[model samples]
Target: MIGTEFIAQSPETKPFWEAAGAGRFVLPRCRQCNRTHWYPRGICPHCLSTTIDWQDSPGEGEIYSFAINRMGKEPYVVAYVALTEGPIMLTNVIDADPGALSIGTSVKVTFKPAVTQAPVPLFVVR
Candidate 1:
């Protein structure tokens, strides 16, 4: 119940949340382009191919970029994770000690409920 501010989980992203609830990092992998992408799509953004599959990832990544919010309504760490399979996921980095996280730091995926509906992928320092 850390930040249950009533986030509406979209139907398009429901599968991703469902996977996270099962402790899996599911993403859309385009078979034609051989690349993975976040915000799952029906067609490959790279090649415009409709051959897509849901694959489980290792959930290991690095902090490609980050910001330490100190003055926001509720301070938090927002980061872009460069996943091993070449997908960049925009997520919140949790359980980080203040001033401890930085760009390029290694991170791992963790799950927390998305407003009690389903688990969502969150990141933390490895």
Candidate 2:
């Protein structure tokens, strides 16, 4: 989580951050399209419906893709994790060697507190 940043929650994203603060992972599921998506919002992107609700996810997924940035003082991993719920989220992988991670690596959601007081969602090898 070398560069994970948490920001002040807006109305559309408050519950998400609150749930994360409480150690729960939630995603917006579109009631109309019955699909989940990354980057929470007031309206469902898939169906363009306002009938969106929060659903608690198991928060486990496989690495869809990744890259290691070794130029930083300490190398860190940047990755796209394909969640079991069907959305691919951009996140960082922690607590493992960069050389040990690759496509299809299993990972689980983890939260880290930021100066903004909101929890940043990250991942770790599962």
Cα TM-score per model: 0.84, 0.92
- lDDT, residue 98, model 1: 44
RMSD of 1: 3.3
Candidate 2 accuracy as TM-score: 0.92
- Residue range with the least summed lDDT across 10 consecutive positions in model 2: 1-10
lDDT of each: 0.76, 0.86
Q: Write the per-residue lDDT of candidate 2 for residues 10-76, one digit (tens) a residue.
A: 8988888888889899998999999998778889888899988999998999999999999879999
The per-candidate count of clashes, in order, stands at 0, 0
Per-residue accuracy of model 1 over 1-126 as CA lDDT, tens digit each:
222123346765566667777888888888897888876767788899988888988889998987777786767887778888888877788888748887889998887765566776788889
* Best-fitting candidate, scored by lDDT: 2
